[model samples]
Target chain A: MTKRIQQFLNEQKPATPCVVIDLDVIKNNYGSMRTHLPLAQVFYAVKANPAPEVVNLLVNEGSSFDVASVPEVDLCLSQGANPDNISFGNTIKKEPHIAYAYSKGIRLFAFDSEEELLKISRAAPGSKVYCRILVENEGAQWPLSRKFGCEVEMAEDLLCQARELGLVPYGVSFHVGSQQTDLSQWDVAMTRVASLFMTLQERGIELTAINLGGGFPAHYIEHVEEMPAYADAVMRAIVGHFGNRLPKLMIEPGRSMVGDSGVLQAEVVLVSRKSNDDCKRWVYLDAGKFNGLAETLDEAITYRVTTSRDGEETEPVILAGPTCDSVDVIYEKKEYSLPLGLKAGDLVQFHSTGAYTTSYASVNFNGFEPIKAYCI
Target chain B: MTKRIQQFLNEQKPATPCVVIDLDVIKNNYGSMRTHLPLAQVFYAVKANPAPEVVNLLVNEGSSFDVASVPEVDLCLSQGANPDNISFGNTIKKEPHIAYAYSKGIRLFAFDSEEELLKISRAAPGSKVYCRILVENEGAQWPLSRKFGCEVEMAEDLLCQARELGLVPYGVSFHVGSQQTDLSQWDVAMTRVASLFMTLQERGIELTAINLGGGFPAHYIEHVEEMPAYADAVMRAIVGHFGNRLPKLMIEPGRSMVGDSGVLQAEVVLVSRKSNDDCKRWVYLDAGKFNGLAETLDEAITYRVTTSRDGEETEPVILAGPTCDSVDVIYEKKEYSLPLGLKAGDLVQFHSTGAYTTSYASVNFNGFEPIKAYCI
Candidate 1:
């Protein structure tokens, strides 16, 4: 925990199962991204953590936003973001919501399919639209299924058709995947995107932008390379593929912007063994998959844990949330060690959980209120 | 869809991505339980769907409650349920919450470990405590992990210790699993419980209640046995082992009590293929895994769907929820067919969603509101 978060926790002592976000950390992350990737314009992905405080801070930092819904557009604009700086980045949007966004003065949007493009044309006329082409999500810890993007050839046709539909075929976009580790995936993506640009140019549609959809990782159980390394690799990929004719670059950083900025403090609800001679321990926490840690569904995003009884003898334990549902078990197959002395009421801190945790909490599953987040 | 739900949808036209629950269906389901399992007292599990209307109706019907949290206890009480009819069924609970439940006049509790039992004794002294023994989850579609119940031998010792700790050694409970298809699993659980009862009787503690933890099936894609069939098997297992001296039987029904009562109405946001030549269509809906259809994770529960274009020629489609996250894909591996003419703005209804649908919705994962529930 940072001194700021530690001091806040000590002084306020908010109830267990709440997250404390350090604003200074988000500001610092923004600064690091800017310094490392100066060529790219930063579009903060609001779905990662749409806390007003985070948005306001990013707004002050002159950050553009990659919004997924109309509410996000309203949120960003309410916090003093220029509509020009907001991009409706979700490919799947309701036609009415697109109109609502357009009415609010948002001009940029993303679409993966021709049907969605038609909706955009009818709703947000002359809006700058980008086609998200499907790219390999190999080497990502949380690999994205082929849900968001489309084939490169189809994207080329979509852009050519965009002109006829009275929409600006701005550029192309692709996601390597969330928490992507291998830098070579970006190389492959950039190469494919460069070919698409060449193909589109031949079709008389000049694309001006390239949305490098969020694939940059946050600190997880695995050792993640810093922004500098990712920036270096991304810049190399762009420069190596595009040569002198560089397109306007946009990077939507969701997890990297705020993931490490918060710490989720949960209390141990129960600790037990199925049998007396059972070697493994079962540790149940107050917060669970429904409340916050939904990323732990497949044990995909393992948050580094620090307990109140740290430094005590540790042993592998199965972690679960305090719910009646059996699927609420956090980590059973993966080995996670906790202090042997850890018992009910012991505080457990999940680190680097600022991004996806709070936003994914259920309304009142099992009568537990959504996990609370306190931004400092 | 039921005529009531269909009529309510036509009249209300509330919005896309909402659950319309027919209270009469819940009443009928409750009535079915009473008709089939006349011997066992029904303890309606509130976590499945804690809609106040559902609770109030069950309360009026004299159904006892199985609450997992303090809020659930309060919800049941607020709905005119007697505290004596409520059971703190979750084995994993905080000590303070236990005290709160006790303060609110709750006495029954569930426990699997010594630590939890110790807490209950300190917090809610002299409570009617039951041991949850681990049982096979082999035949369950949604098999519960060992996060809940303990080893049968360990459960025996725990019940014996419950007496020593000043708490009433009430009974034993075991869950076959959620969405359980196999009836034989109940037989195995009962035989073990019968053996435990004999062991406890010899030890001079007279256990009364035998909690047949919920494993009842709700309507999904698979054919489910009628309530009478399940009730008969369960009663036979109890009578076959205990002979003339049947223990006080308690059945906790969550899913079966409420599952078939709801119809989730969602609009198709977009319909597209990855490529023009792609074999399957990708259909996006306003509701998804984070919203009403959480059981669709791993395609565990395949809901029967009715589209506005239902009569049109159908084709196998990849179904996904409307979210930026790739993990939001609802059913990819499972062969879910949709109307060939299905397009944006088409209404699709997912049936048998009254239980876990609205309860598991994320608060604001992608700036989209939680799936709304309206009980009529």
Candidate 2:
């Protein structure tokens, strides 16, 4: 556990099975991003955490927001973020939501489909729009298959359609994938964005910005390159690809910004072996995929787990969430070792889980309360 | 689409991306189960749907409930269900929850661990307890894994311990698995239960009930044998395994009881091909994993999807939920054919989604509202 988390736990002794976020850590993370990418504007992805405190902290830090829906726009706006600084980032949106965002004076938006572009044109006439191009998401811990982006050719057509439909064809964007580890992936994605920018430029549509969607990774179980290293790689690639013709660079960092800042203190509900000769021990925690930690789906985001009991004989165990549903097992295939003497009431602190944990919590499953989050 | 759903849509024209539950279907399902298993009492698994209307209907029909938490117990009580008829079925529970349930006059409880037994003993002393035995969940669509239940020897020990702790050793229960297809799996599970029952009887503990637990499959992609056939098979297995002397039989049916009774009407946000040569069309729905239909995690539940444009030329498409997250792609690996002309404003109805759909909905992700459910 980090010293900060230990200190918080020692001081507060918060009820088990709650998310504790350190605002100071978040401030440091935001500062690092600003220092590393001086040329790039940071837009915090609200869907990752969406905690009021996290949003307010980022807003106070002079950061913008990448919002997906009308409520998100409302949240950012309520947090004192300027509407101009918020981008309606979701490509698939309801017409009413589009109109609501427009009514709120939020002009920046993203779309990958012609229909979506048309919807935006009708709902928010002449709004600034960015088309997202689909790219191969290789080496990403959480690979985004074909959910958001359109093909390069289709993106070009969509941008042309946007301009013809009276919507401003302002920029291009693409996500390398969430929790993306390979920095070279940005080089490939930026090259594609630059090529698209040049293509649009030839067609007399001068783009003003390039929205680099959220993918920056957080250090969890695996060692990841620091923010400065990612920034250097991104800057070098932009200069190599776009030269002096660089548009306003923008980045949406969800996980990297808040992931390491939050710690989940979950209590061990039970620990037992199914059979006497069974090799694996089962450790059940109060929270699970339904309550929170839904990112554990397929074990895509491996959270580094630490128990209060340390330096004891360790054994690989199957970590499961406390729910009636059998599918709530968190770590069964993956090898996760914990102290053999671990028992109920022992605090197991999951590190760097601020992002994607609380936001994905279901309201009630098997009657368990949603994972409570506390911002310190 | 089913005539009932079409009629409901044409008449009510409810907002898209909502769950429509057919209470008549639930009534018929409950009646059928009661008729088929005359000896077995039906405890409707509230976690499956938990919709107030569904619970009230079940309560009015004099059905029991298998609840997992205090809130579930409260829901049942609020719905006018007798507390004696509701069993606290979740094996892993907090002490406070046990105390709360006990204070509410709930007596029947289930546990699989010594720590849990102790908690129950302190909280709900002298409560009727059932020990679940871990069984091989082979041929199950949604396998339980090692999340619930313990070994046969351990179960016997636990039951004995429950008696020593002044709790009534009420029964033995086992779940064959969710969406279980093979009926023979129940026979195997019952045999194990019978053996344990005999062992417990020899040790001066008479088990009163046998909870077959929830496994009873719902009609999804495959045709399922009717409730009568399942009840018949279970009766024969019980008769064959235990001869003339039989315990009071009970079943907790979650998916099968309510799965087929619900229909989800989701609007197509957009449909497009990623590339010219791309073989599959991508169809985006307004509701997704975050909003509801989370059972699509690994495509465990294959929902039968229908569109308003039925009878039009059909094409295999990659179905996805509307979200900015790339992992929101629903059926990329599995082949799903949809109307070739499906577009925005078209309605796509997912059948047999009544059970797990609304209950698993997240409060808010990407600003999408939880899938609302209406009972008709």
Best candidate per TM-score, number? 1
Quality of candidate 1's docking, in CAPRI categories? high
DockQ of each: 0.93, 0.71
Model 2 chain A poorest 10 in a row by lDDT: A1-10
Give residue B231's lDDT in candidate 2 (0 to 100): 85
Candidate 1 residue pairs in backbone clash: none
User: Model 1's chain B TM-score?
Assistant: 0.99
Mind giving the per-residue lDDT tens digits that candidate 1 earns over B135-172? Answer: 88988999988888888888888998999999999999
TM-score of chain B of each: 0.99, 0.98
Q: How well is each residue in A1-376 modelled by candidate 1, as lDDT tens digits? A: 8999999988998998999999999999999989998878999999999999999999999999999888888899999999999999999999999999999899999998999999999999999999999999899988989998889989999999999999999999999988999988999999999999999889998899999988898887899888889998999999999998899999999999999999999999999999989999999999989998999989999999999999999999999999898889888888888899998889999999999999999999999999989999
The estimated TM-scores of all candidates read: 0.99, 0.96
Cα deviation at A348, candidate 1, in Å, is 0.6
Best by DockQ: 1
Alpha carbon lDDT at B7, candidate 2: 92
